[model samples]
Target: MTDRFRELVVNDSLVDIQYKTDPPTETVSPRVTYDRDDVPHVYCMKKTIPLSAFMERYARGEQRMWLAAYRPSNGRQTTITFAKHDRLTFGKRFIDAVAAERAHLFAPAQDSDGDASAPPPISSKKTAEVSSKAAKKISLEELELSLALQREIGRLGEDAAYRHEYVRLHALDCPNPAEHIVRISEDDVGAGYDMRSTFAGQTRYIEVKASTTRMDSFYISENERDTLAKVGQEAFIYLCRVDRDAPKNSAVVREIRDPMNPESGILLEAVAYKAKLSN
Candidate 1:
């Protein structure tokens, strides 16, 4: 072999040895980045899940999780809403509802009675909320709405549209979703259920209750109880438990089928009273 060729072979061998002994230097994880206006923006990879799915998977499908995102660059603010508590004022209630929920600070949406004009008690058969405990009358239906319970849900005012849409989407899924679900509350407050879903020759009388607290406590109006008795197996309730800080994987839709039945896992208290006034 020529001297120059031998020298080249020796150099190649040395380079191979160097590669076998050296260790790699850098490791990189997956990330998302955007460059705009000659500026670099980097973010960790995150899945943009739908709000409905977020609600369904959160807290066993009993409550909702809310997030308020403020994007100053886009001049957009995301606001959340629930009914207010009676003990707390408007500002305090707003802050508390959005704050980290503590056991003591936890309060479910109040019964219907807080509005100034008393839009209407949220306790009718078609109404999705309960009546104010404070409202008094000879019978359950005679309670006064002006007592102002200042609850955190079932306002049935501007928020009614939101609740209706939320319940409608959550009630059922079909190719023609809107067509199968009828909003009974909008047309008839005495129907004993908020929405009715008719699918595949089966019908469901659905009572939609939007709850802000984690408690399972609720008051059933006379009409609702009567309907539960009349439609034994067809009775269904969608108890939506809403929380501003519900976990990302919590449940949004919890269906209570045959709600009044013992096998349904719901506890119902019954009391038949005959009180006669004696002078």
Candidate 2:
């Protein structure tokens, strides 16, 4: 049976959506222009966006939805906006109705092109990123193992980076550099910092993140978050962006200081929590 698509109309605007089977949940910005018939029949909405972008926008904010589409005659694609609450309600109803009818498709697309003012739609131009918290199945052991491996890799990168920094300081002949440069990752005693180092008499705490891919995003533990808040300028995140296949000492180190500030635009997503039974 063919899968059905869902549709909703809002403020003279029509929004239509369906799920794609793509595994990578990254938003693919619309690249090519689609003809009027190719676009969805929603009020001036285009059908060029991937399912990932929809979910990404939903992740950032559930109150609204964004769509990529443009007028039929107009060539430029535009972002169409709508209230998600109302539209999603209609969508659930549509799905239930189709299911009641034992329809092969859950929410089939409608041929009704929206109001005349609505234009033919174009695909999305932005790629949206998926968050790890999104519902996906995995065994508890697998999850723990994956996390442990990631942490171990990160620690390796962090240790390498710290040693590199230490060597640089020693080369500079800084006063008792060995006394100042210390690895603190061994204990919670150092708080959220992974390594403590001094340069020109000032002490700085460093947190490290190691990634095989370019760091478009990274995880920040609650300890790191709180440490940033408390220490302010003294705290730094040393991003060890490594090309694993490359020879040794080839990782690019980028430092982000005071990342917890509101202007940083860093999103803190809670992936795990400790449960406490109520008394």
Candidate 3:
């Protein structure tokens, strides 16, 4: 990734840093400016870093990047690729991506029964059916904590809801399905909203709450509430009740719009307070 960034800096005069995949230009290397010509949060240009200034600095940091990669390999830690399995990894979405790769490498040659054909594009059933034949590959300690599993379930809910919105709008013949709905949670972590859709043609900002146990309860961050207040009635919360055993089948069961409105009958509780030390 750092190498790719170096290529961009060396080749391009000025590069735009909008998405996460873009190089981390704001890493105190360049004469970076929060060079925004438009307002923040509406998907306009936010920050532009002058990479020419940091070309030397960034090039020098290649040593640090190599050290990071080398140490993890030598210490028997997860690789940078597998480290992204940060979610519940309760053997779900995170595994789904690398499942085929893992199976191809470790899985034994299967029986001829006309099944030794080319594999499908890494689905759960195929990965499991093929890999299950091997010896016990993963142990209990290799798994994440219960809380992390719960978070993974929550992510499953988010994934389900994201797909639903895109499909629902497309099925309903929304003029532009691509423009009408977007999964903001993937790209914009601090946007306070998970999705952007249309409600009666008005812009709808949606915050999704997916729980394995209860749909009625989930923590709301300060940014989420602020978005609800600012967006007014167009703001909504999609409750996705996920089934741990079957995450892919889960779907958004409820949609609450404008919870900030007293008539909507939703409540917010303050969980913690910050304090400043006496001067």
Give the winner by TM-score: 3
State the lDDT of candidate 3 residue by residue for 80-176, as single tens digits: 2212233213333323323333454445455678465443333232222214455243322223333456666767888888877878787887767
- Per residue, candidate 1 scores C-alpha lDDT tens digits across 67-141 of 232232453433221121121222223223222222112334455785333232333432233347654212121
lDDT, residue 11, candidate 3 = 18
Can you tell me which runs of candidate 2 are displaced by over 4 Å? 1-141, 167-172, 243-247, 250-252, 269-279
**Residue-by-residue lDDT tens digits, candidate 2, 1-279:** 112222333322332232221233222221232234443223223444433233333332234344554443444444444332222212233323333432321223455674333222213332233357552333232233345446546766776677667776888887666777778877664478788888786777888888866788887778778987788877777878654334265453777777888766667888778999999
Better of 2 and 3 by lDDT: 3
Runs of candidate 3 exceeding 4 Å displacement? 1-88, 92-144
Colliding residue pairs in candidate 3: none
Q: Report every candidate's CA lDDT.
A: 0.42, 0.51, 0.52
